[model samples]
Target chain A: MEIVRPTLLLDKETCLRNIARMAEKAKAKNLDFCPHFKTHQSAIIGEWFREFGISAITVSSVQMAQYFARNGWTDITIALPVNILEIDQINQLASGINLNLLVENKESLVFLDKFIKFQAGIYIEIDTGYNRTGVAAHKTNLVDGLLEIVKNNKLLDFKGFLSHTGHTYQASSRHDIFNHHFDALLKMRSLKNRYKKDWPNLKLSLGDTPSASICDNFDGIDELRPGNFIFYDLMQYKLGTCKFEDIALRLVCPVIARHASRNEVIIYGGAIHTSKDSIINIDGKELYGQVIINQNGQKILLDERNYLHKLSQEHGIIKVTYKDFNSFKVGDLVEIVPVHSCLTANLMGSYLTSDGEYIPTIRQA
Target chain B: MEIVRPTLLLDKETCLRNIARMAEKAKAKNLDFCPHFKTHQSAIIGEWFREFGISAITVSSVQMAQYFARNGWTDITIALPVNILEIDQINQLASGINLNLLVENKESLVFLDKFIKFQAGIYIEIDTGYNRTGVAAHKTNLVDGLLEIVKNNKLLDFKGFLSHTGHTYQASSRHDIFNHHFDALLKMRSLKNRYKKDWPNLKLSLGDTPSASICDNFDGIDELRPGNFIFYDLMQYKLGTCKFEDIALRLVCPVIARHASRNEVIIYGGAIHTSKDSIINIDGKELYGQVIINQNGQKILLDERNYLHKLSQEHGIIKVTYKDFNSFKVGDLVEIVPVHSCLTANLMGSYLTSDGEYIPTIRQA
Candidate 1:
């Protein structure tokens, strides 16, 4: 395919393999593989999950849930804390599909209980040290208040406790990741143990790509909703969650100019295409992306010395070594493995498969 | 008028005032105001510039140039370095509009010389300490080679040196901003003096909001092309380039959840909505955005104690002060002044004016 601008290229085979591995792992452990559609956000890509007998999916917002629902996804869970203002949309979806909503506070439940008319499964989002959102796992009194509101509301069905071990992403080492995951598992299990007596068949849902990719001990967790695993990025690779080859998405950008004086190459890709998500490199500076040159029918991954160093609105400045700098010229397409695939994918809206098919995402939908 | 999701709120009066102030500044100095449209990529907003007699405009890509061209903008400069791969589009745009393109190297001119079919203006992008993209001002031999090619090519009109003093954004003080701007002025002046004998009507264009907003001196420059000043952000505010009141855009996001124990609020806005641009706060941590509580129909700017601290794919964690924390609850819409307006504006694709009208940007177009 002739890529003139910054286009996200998805390797279908690699993406399928990633799905198969995660799906197989979940099946072996007998855990529900309700992978988060927020990562791919594409209906066509969501259909790929069906090959592994996966019928349920997890989205991040009401709009995403609506998007997937329209695409024939019946059983879906919105993992984001319920925005009571979107109760109208929630009711619309809940009336048709088996929509599950997440609630972390009694206020959300109070609001949802008052406004929601259709049956919707409710998951009390339990905090397992992520501290971004969710009720603390230890706060059973608060959980009781929320569950009481759920019990009082005929439309709301208490599903179980849900936690995203997002703290695993900040792990300094694999040992740290395991420790964070294990601690979260214990907290989630404690909540399940306390509540499962009254709500038997309550399912524990845990998410975050780092924990799901590395941890095998899902003893009490019933479902996994790891999103970024489907399109593993440089951030995941840095965290040792996935191998470099497992990453399926690449941003193909055209080289516009080369500055040999500073050993830099300017590409059409920038914050607009890559979304400015960065990781610290060995030099202790921000590394925007890992650069790979696609030239002469060969893809050559440049060394750590040659990486995307800076980004503006519509310009990506790649700091390259002298040896690699001369290899690049204007009009060549260079593939960038973004620091965060989810954000990059969201920015691009659609992806061009390696075979040259336009796969529209939730943004386009 | 009712916003349930993360919406970019544009205050039309504030935005128009910003445009008038910049236009007046350019007029007072007798400098041509060809403001960069990369920030507010809306054709409707672009029309606002016409009131101030801004007929010429600057864009960062060929697609953006084409978008503006279709919207009736005749004199357009694609401020990005010429991508030889898009010669076909360049030829098409040049044939219809008074198109101008930036070229930093002889190779681009050589390629343009070979393929360009219609009359096009060429600006040799000069590196005036901003080593992102541009030829060094002192490199007269290299400049001569580029000019030689432009002189030989009948279609490529030589439009003198253009420098984006973007390094002014990194200035620690207003003095530093002046120093950076003055240094660029000196360098650009040197280039103009050396080349004016050959090309009498050559023009020097300067860009970047920091330099344009604060620096009063534009002695040697012929045109100014600042974009971000149109939507002055927290970054511009922090740099002492613009007042907080000058910021015209805000990401109005609904509060989904609030945790009192840690004094944190989770907004529906995330990396997807805000684009992850951050400014280091006084606390010496990454501050994603400054929060303004829009409760009870009154706007209250929360102190530095409360700020957006973290962002994930679909979540934004705002660290709030204990005193202000109680004022927030589920479903309250909070306004966040973004660190960088351009990226946030690009991600949002469209804006809802304070009067409740949808303003579509280039992303939406």
Candidate 2:
């Protein structure tokens, strides 16, 4: 692709390999591999997973479900807690497909039952340790109360228990990820064992890229919904979840100016292009992103010694040793591995594929 | 406006007041009031500045300059350095109107001279202390070389020196902001003074919200281009650049779930909507944003004691005291004073005015 201001470059080969790896893992475990489409957010990219016979998918919002549903995704689970205000959208999205909504309380279930005209699958979101959302797994009374309301409503189908181990992103080591994944699996299994007698076909779901990529003990988890594996970022790399070769996306920005005195090269990418998500550096500064040099269309990740250290609104300052900094002049294309790929992809609404094809994502208003 | 998800709400009254305030400041200082339109990247919001008798404006990208130019803006200076890859678009933009391009190196100037067809004004960007981009103010030989080349070129219109003191954002006290502003003013003045004998009507420009809002000295700075004053956010509020009442934009999001045990409320807004820019709270945790209850159509800023404490990809956890938490019910709208308004505005891409009108921003594939 031509080097412009800032282009999000996607390597289709790497993305396909990533998709295949996760799909094969789920198949090996005899689990439902419902990859979360929120990471790629592209119907074209989603089709790459269809080659693996994956039909059901997971999204974070109702609008996303509608987007993918219109694009021929028949079954979509909105993994976020139900926003009662979006009942109209939820009903509209559920009108033609098997739409799933997560609920932790009876208020949302009652609101869905009263407003939604079409059949909507409901899942009681269990807090398996993330603590960001979802009901505590030990809160059996609350879970039963929500389940009771969901069961009483003819329009609502009680799907199962769903939980997301998001805290794995903060894990310091692979052991931490496995421990979090283990605890989540134990709580979800215990909850499923308690309620399986009442509802025979309820499915247990766990989704998170870090745990899903490293852990193999998926014995009872019915469905797996790991996104980000398709385009693992620096955060995943730091968490020891994915290797650098599996990263499918890189932000190609133009070198605007060079500060040879400071050994810094500034680019046209910043917090807007790569959202202010960052990991702590060894020097205690926020590592906005890392610099990579592309040779013959292959991205070569640089050493951690040189990285995009500081960012303003529309400017990124990369601190490099003179040898690394001397390799580029102004107006040359500089590739950066964003701190978080999902946010970077979101900021860049479209992508230029490796074959020089521009593909629009599902972020347009 | 009905906010089913995270909605960017714009208050026209306060925004106009802010525009008037900065314009009046520039008028009082005998400086050109060329405000930066990068913060509120909306043509409708741009029209608000026209009411203050402002014509020439500054944008951060060529796409944004083209956007405003297509909507009848005649003069726009792209504050970013010229990217050689966008030479075609720059030529197209420069053909119809008086376009300004920033250049700091000889390579970009040579490319523009060879490729650009229309006359484009050039400003040599000087670095005061930000170290993000631009040539150092002390590099007189480099500046003189660039001037010699520009003088030899017919298509390049040489404007004066321009520098932005971005370090003002990191200032601990008002005294630090004053000192940073003072240093930038001195460096830019010395550069302009060195070249003023050659070019009689050279214009010196400086832009940044924190320093511009606090500093009264504009001895040699000929133009002011402050942007964030239009929608001052938590960062500016913390830096004493703007009052909370002057903050015109707020992200109105729905409360999807409430965790009473943790005294936390989960909102549908996340890093995708807020951009993950944060500040430190009193208790030493990162505060992504502060919660403000919308009293009728007006936003009332709450105490900093209760704020958004944690964030995930699609969820924001607001740590609230029970009293503040109980005031908000699930599905109730909560306005967030984001840590940085510029990034938040870019993410939302549109706004719902307080007068109940929807305004679409200039962001599309």
Candidate 3:
């Protein structure tokens, strides 16, 4: 099969191995392994997880939950804090599957109670360190207030406490990641204990790629959800979450134009194919991704010290240095390890297997 | 009409006005107007240009040209250099339309001659300051050698020179933009004069958002092509290419969560919705875009001091300043003018017109 230029190449063997490894980790810990569906977003990829005896899943949005529901996934936890605006969609989702919702505020609880008629598990999101979302972890009153609403309202089911330690992405070393995971688990355990007297069967859910990938100690946590582990990226590699060899997805882009004077090569892959996510390399330089040999599959350390400096609508400018300058020519295909593989895979909209097979993907509304 | 959160909004009136204004400028200069389709990438939007009397159009890829061809656009130019890998697609395109191709080297010319059967107009891309692509403007011998290939080849029609002065994006002021335009045109005119002695009726096509948006002078050029004018973004606004009122596209996002302590608002729109392109403000601080009134339809300064700093898959972190912090609350929708509107629009798949209307977009393979 003739492979098209600027296509995503997925190693099926590597991908399946990664899935099994994650599932094995969850099984050994005797924890509920709700692998985040946001990473692979494909029904076919989801089938691989199902092959490993994974039934329950986690999604970032109500729309994603709907997509997976249509794909025959019976149970799904919409991991994002319940956006009251999507009450109709949530209600629609709940009518079919065992839909679980997340809430970080009182307003969401009020909105859910008014709109939703069916009983849906509501997980209170605790903000351990990632200030992006969720209520403060130590806010006992906030948790009490949410539980109070649950008691008064018969529509919602209190599903204990949930936290995503997203700050683990900023970890510079393995120790930093382990510490973040340990601290977050302790916080979640404390929150569950605080509410244990009332609920008695409270569950503690912890998530984040770094926390789940590096640390095996999940003694206090009842469930684990790590998404990006399915196809780890350069950022994950830098954070010590996953090694470079473990990355399963790569963008195969053909060199359309080569600028010999400036030591630059223009690839068909752009910001649209590989996302604009960047990571500081071992040399302490910012790079979008590293270029690897298409045939030999060896890493090419290009000069000019830049990975992808500028990206237009359909063009990727790869800045090259002197040592690696003479190696590339026009029409040569190079595989790029995207900085954020999950986002990049989502953006590319399609993927080609290593053996040259096309797998179409549907976008979530 | 209930609107979905995190959608691209296009003002039809502003879009039409911008189109008419560009057409008027091209008419006054006695130049053919061929708007680049990369900005919109919509068949419906292309039809709007056609209604405005646009006969020819420009696209960044052969696939895009094919897309417009299927939509009944005949006169199309693939703006980027002819990729040898895509020669078959270009050949298929040439069979349908008056396809104009861009080329920078002898190798591409040689490779294209093998499969190209029909008469295809070839534009010798001249590098004028922007060292991204094209042959150096000062290289007469190189130009002569390339023209010789056109003279020897019967399938290729030498349609003179074309240039995209992308350096205008970095202009400090309106004068700087004008100077960049002036310098680019002067160089193109000199090359045209030098080549006209041998091949008269040589067409000079100069394109770029800055030149097309601001420059009134187009004395020697036969055609003007600019794509980004259809969706004027914050970058264009900062470059003085277009006014804030002229920015036709905006990402309509719903406020999902808010943090009172940090004075930050988390929105459903993320890096996927708004590409990571950013611009510096008046105070020398970087900002993505301004946040506008959600329901009031009034323009509000987004407390430019802060930023939409970190973004997850479906979440955006809008750092709220002390001034605007308390003004915002959970569940309030906001409009963010993307730093680069074209990239944002492309990533979004298409636009969701205000009033909850869905506009389908054409995607290139």
Candidate 4:
């Protein structure tokens, strides 16, 4: 609690603010606030969302769902395509709670249908252009077959189609993200209308932080599952989705060594702690993270030219200004706004709240 | 102990073989084998090296040094430049056993001299073209100043210059790696020769997997500190340093979804499990990791076409050949040879040994 090495510092106020804002946004849009628990990966953090009346949750892995379920979460949707290998655990999970799964193919559907003993909700993943995963929106034949298989299964409850417009992270401006969101809305709306006759209460799910944060048009969606909004990072800040203040998590690294000639301060943090997500800055330099100063218990994001330039396994080099180099001595704790908070949170495995309370990772539990 | 999800699988036999081979190399070369424990970051793995008659060890963090020290590693080197803030821990650690610290500045040396209650071995980190950290190799003035400060300090034992020939990773072939190693060898030998008259027992410390693995030319180096060789990754294999069989670690991920048309399989492992270290392949495409098949208990590296192309937080997209894709189902466990095993190992936090024993991480211990 005395803040010694590269510790992930979480501000509860900022974090709760972020969660409340997103939950309110969903409420205003008349959409289901199914917050994703993959980012924080903590049952304690899950309780924060629960405080805002969020019950339906999204997670990336079955192991995660089990972790949350063991901690008393009931309504869970694994946003990732179901790992049919984990059917035993899935079946066990679904038997006791409202378990939702994602599937993109017939083999997965058939396997679940044959093996599942309990009622399960199924969401067909639609690929709107991310090309990462999901069936193509234009593939009507595939969608129809997928739906047919789900309908045939007595235990499986056809939820709806889920699409994560991940490419919105690549959008150049807020307007660009809005366009991408509109495009996804149109795609999901069309699919929802097409299937409304068959399944009357089909819900279209859209999740992605940039689109959810930048765009206000959530009229056609039934649920919103933006996980990263809980701890918006430098990536979101650069994408214009969140301000510096909204970026809640900061890795506090100690200044280990100083290279005055280079105007650099080596920190006791690296790829292991902050991760290797570097962003190209305006100066054509790759910034692993931005330096921020924790003054009198308040974190002030430094808009200075100083940057966390490089990171090895356990070493981070922060290129600082001459004044900064002279002011900070070896062993001083400098807060860094990580490029991606989700990955950083995962790597750190836990968070040290600013109030000095140690929050255990869901994995730890 | 059935691997439920994204488990870090370590073949202990292969890992032991790797350690033995490196220890044997160091023995034959007449150099002290101080293998960096940063790769495994496990006290159990440290004990594996101890079985090979390894007494001293190298680590990247002070906390890690304490972890290994607590686990019975007496002679330890905190290889990264000393974080002046951890003087208390360093002093406490040094008082118990032989503790070596890296320093590149007079301020750090002065602070250590004034505060350190126990004697400490100091290694001036020399920059050998990596430019990431360390004092530039050509800066004799800086080196002399650093040496003078150490020599002036009564508690500080001035160890020889330590340089990591990291540029060996950038080399195209084994010949190029040899050139980088040879260049570093010359620079370190020159530094040693220059200071040999004053400090006869001063030994040169060199590390980096590519330099240590590719070239057997370790005539001048007094200590070999290569870490990554123990769990050689796709990066090391690509650098022509380690053979495919030498790779000791693999991430076992389950296939969640299958895209038959594009021959892509969505795996339940991603940036969170595998640190995003992508390497450019022969076709000039960025590859996260290579898919390896388990055939009759032997792990076979699929080197031709399959690649872990894209990764989200918990999703890994492996683009594969149609035949290979068809052969595997949604529940098959595929091993991936990570691009950088050090970072990958760091992310996973623990290992499931081939013997089915769960190895606790250094942090856990």
Q: What is the C-alpha lDDT of each candidate?
A: 0.91, 0.88, 0.83, 0.87
Which rank order by DockQ, best down to worst?
Answer: 1, 2, 4, 3
lDDT tens digits by residue: candidate 2, A117-156? 9998988999988888888999999988888787788999
Stretches of candidate 1 exceeding 4 Å from the true structure: none
Model 3 misses residue A136 by how many Å?
Answer: 0.7
DockQ of the candidate models in sequence: 0.84, 0.77, 0.59, 0.71
Candidate 2 CAPRI grade? medium
Q: How would you encode candidate 4's per-residue C-alpha lDDT over A1-365 as one tens digit per residue? A: 57777889999999999998998999999999898899999988888887899888999988899999998999999999888878889999998999999988888888888999999999999998777888899888999998888888889999999999998988888888888889889888889889999999888999999988878888779999999999999989989999888988989988877777778888889888887888997689889999986567785666648889888888898888876667567767898989998888988888989788889886566
lDDT of 3 by residue, A255-313 (tens): 77778888888887787778877876556666788887544666653432647766777
lDDT of 1 by residue, B1-365 (tens): 78999999999999999999999999999999999999999999999999999999999999999999999999999999998888899999999999999998878888899999999999999989978989888999999899888888788899878999889988888899999999999999988888899999999999989999988889988999999999999989999998999999999999998877788888999999996878889899999899998768889999888999999887899999888988888899999999999999999999999889999988777
Over the stretch B44-97, how does candidate 2's per-residue lDDT look in tens digits? 889989889999999999889989998889999999988888988999999999
DockQ of 2: 0.77
> Where is model 2 chain A poorest over a 10-residue stretch in terms of lDDT?
A293-302
Candidate 3 chain A weakest lDDT stretch, 10 residues: A295-304
Which regions of candidate 2 fall more than 4 Å away from where they truly are?
Answer: A294-299, B294-300
lDDT by residue for model 3 (B116-158), tens: 8787999999999988888999988989888888998888999
- Best-performing candidate as measured by DockQ: 1
Per-residue lDDT of A316 in model 1:
96
Model 2 chain B TM at 0.97
Deviation from truth (RMSD, Å), model 3? 2.1
Runs with alpha carbons beyond 4 Å of true place in candidate 4:
A294-301, A321-327, B138-141, B294-300, B322-324
For candidate 1, give the lDDT of residue B162. 93
* Candidate 4 residue pairs that clash: none
